[model samples]
Target: MAKNKGSSRKGLMLVVLLLVLALGAGGANLYVLWSQSGKTQASELEDMPAAEPVPEPPHYVALEPFTVNLQSSQYDDRLLYVVITLGVADEQSKQQIEDYRPHLRSRLLMLLGEQEDEALLASGGRQALAEKVLALFDEPFAERLTAPQVKEVLFTEFVIQ
Candidate 1:
C-alpha cells in the first residue's frame, strides 16, 4: 500500500511540473509576440511621410469708401458708391498699398467715372470691376522690381443710382 501511495504522489508531481512548464512557455511566446507587434507599429510610423503644414490665411488691406459720378448721357446724374478691400499676399504688399493709397484712389476714381450705371448694375459687373481694380494694382510700386502682390479685389459695398 505504501509503495502504491508513493508512486501516485510521484505521478501527480510530474503532471504538475509539465503543466507549469507549458504555461511558462506559452506566456513567454505571448510576450515576444506582443513586443514584436509594438516594434512593427513603431517602425511603420517612422516610415510614413510627414504631414503637410497648413497654409496661412490671406492678409487684407481695406480702402475707404469711394463715391464716383458714373458716365451717362441720357440721365446725366448717375452715381456709384463702393467700398473696396484688397487681399494682399504679405505685409510688404499691404504696406505698399497703404503708401500709394492716394494715387490708387485717383486712378480708381478715373476708372469708376468711365463705367455706365446700366453696365455696373448688370450681372457679374461687380466681379468685372473687381478684376479691373486688381489689374490696376498689379504693377510694381515705384521703381521696385517685384509688383505689389494684390491677389484679389473685393467690394464690400456697391451701389449704383
Candidate 2:
C-alpha cells in the first residue's frame, strides 16, 4: 500500500511538472505574438516604393516603343541593338496594355537584360528574340483580345550594337 501511494505521488508530480512547462512555453509564445502585434505594417509599406500607375489605353496609337543595347557573348565585335514598336489596334486593347505597361516593361527589361551576348551572333537569334517579344506582348491579354485585334509587332530598327 505504501509503495502504491509513493508511485501515485510521483505520477502526480510528473503531470504537474509537464503542465507547468507547457504553460511556460505557451506564455512565451503569446508574449512574442503580443509584442509583434503592435508593430505597424503600414510603416513597412511606406518604406517601399509606390507602384507606378498603369497608363490608360489611348484612343490614338500610343506606340509602346523600346530600344535595348546588348553586347555579343560570342564575339567581342558582335553587338546587338534593337528598337521595337508595338501597334495596338484599339482603345480597349491599348488600355489593357497601358494598364499592364509596368509589368510589360519589367518583363521586357528582364528578357533583354538576360540576353546572352552570343544570342546576337546570328540573324536567326535576333529573329527568334523578336518573335519571343511579340509572343510575350500577346500572352498577357490573350483571352481579352481576339486574333485580328492583336495585329502587329514590328521591329523598326534592328542593328548589331
* Best-matching candidate per TM-score: 1
Candidate 1 local lDDT, 19-131, one digit each (tens): 99999999999999999999999999999998889887889998999999998867969889999988989988888778888878888999998898877777988888888
Model 2, range 30-93, lDDT digits (tens) per residue? 9988777656565778888999999756343334455555655456554445566666667666
Total clashing pairs in model 2: 6
Candidate 1, residue 25: the lDDT equals: 100
Q: On a 0 to 100 scale, what is the lDDT of residue 95 in model 2?
A: 71
TM-scores for candidates 1 onward, in order: 0.71, 0.44
**Model 2 ranges with Cα > 4 A deviation:** 1-80, 141-149
CA RMSD of all predictions:
4.3, 17.5
Range of the 10 consecutive residues with the lowest summed lDDT in candidate 2: 58-67
lDDT for position 9 in model 1: 99
Error of 1 at 82 (Å): 0.3
**Model 1 vs truth, CA RMSD:** 4.3
lDDT of 2: 0.66
